[model samples]
Target: MSTSVGEAVVGVILAGGMASRMGGGDKPLFTLAGRPMLDSVLERLAPQCSRMVLSANGDPARFANYGLPVVADPVTGFVGPLAGILAGMDWAARELPAAELIATVPGDCPFLPRDLVSRLSEARRAQVADIALAASGGRTHNVVGLWPVALRDHLRQAIVAERLRKVALWTSRYRTVSVPWVEGPIDPFLNVNSPGDLEEAERLARMLES
Candidate 1:
């Protein structure tokens, strides 16, 4: 399979959440179907990206084996997924200077679409949008998106000056497009936020594997 669409695109798995709903810990690290959930996400996303990084906080040792860089939120005080997205952008700017864009997907989501980066890239190019986000079942997955690296500075300004918190709020200022995916047997953006959700993911894993 052609894993990379272009050398100018990088992937970032947003994993910085406090995971309070799962009782305070790394939700991506939680085991699902006998494997770490993040591993499944990486498997699907890494091939599509020329390079990939993990947007996470705390000790990076837990993810040491993955070999991908773990970037902490540049903005302090747990600013949510948008912070993670910004961190990813900054990392791409610094490490992959040739990269034009960064694609983000929540680490807790193991069933991310295999064509995620390419479809988002195509949608953004076709629409001439500043950003391209994933949507399913009539709901937008703001955390799962394609962001222009050029927007990093502006995003930093909004976060610092306006205290921007919501992804939709900041994205509204730019020309953005949402690529809707069909909810097959299950939503590709399905994420694990709680213990019960993990159980459901495990069940989904079995179904998808078969």
Candidate 2:
């Protein structure tokens, strides 16, 4: 998917998770550096997308202040991030008809690069890939990816009948391309999954400032 400025590239923040590890609180709403974690994620992704949506299972009103549409998993029972991705694809197919691809980023990944969408989109286009994933330190970050909306049916089938919803597994079925973001002082794809991770993110943020 070749995405130019102003083109219809939908950004989906995957927030539909049970943050059991971090004491069961909403991970995205958790504060990092005196700001909601989602705020930093949205700040990085919003500029690169034509429209943005939050995929959360809980009440959408909680995210009303963000002024972005919050989508719940159409298929219930708390299925994984794949459910969120499917929801995003469905939303893009229905609402943003012109959108060719849905770019997904985890809500806890506050350090995602600002050029994430552009880089992934360009990689997908160059490689003629159906899915484009991010990589840091030689590890593929499958959740941070861009998926073609055209594969909506295949995804839905995989989720419904087979109960196979892992992002990496589904992505492997397609012509997937990985875009490398070489390591630096701060790994751009650092995700805060626990309290300790939040603390580390703060330290990294300070390091960036210094």
Output the number of the lDDT-best candidate. 1
lDDT of 2 by residue, 50-76 (tens): 899999987788888899989999786
Error of 1 at 121 (Å): 0.6
Candidate 1 ranges with C-alpha deviation above 4 Å: 1-3
Evaluated with TM-score, which candidate comes out highest?
1
Question: Model 1's lDDT to the true fold?
Answer: 0.89
Task: Name the regions of candidate 2 deviating beyond 4 angstroms.
Answer: 1-6
lDDT of 1 by residue, 107-188 (tens): 8999998999889988998999999999999999998999999999899998888898998999999999999999999999
Instruction: Report clash pairs, candidate 1.
Output: none
- The alpha-carbon lDDT assigned to residue 202 of candidate 2 equals 94
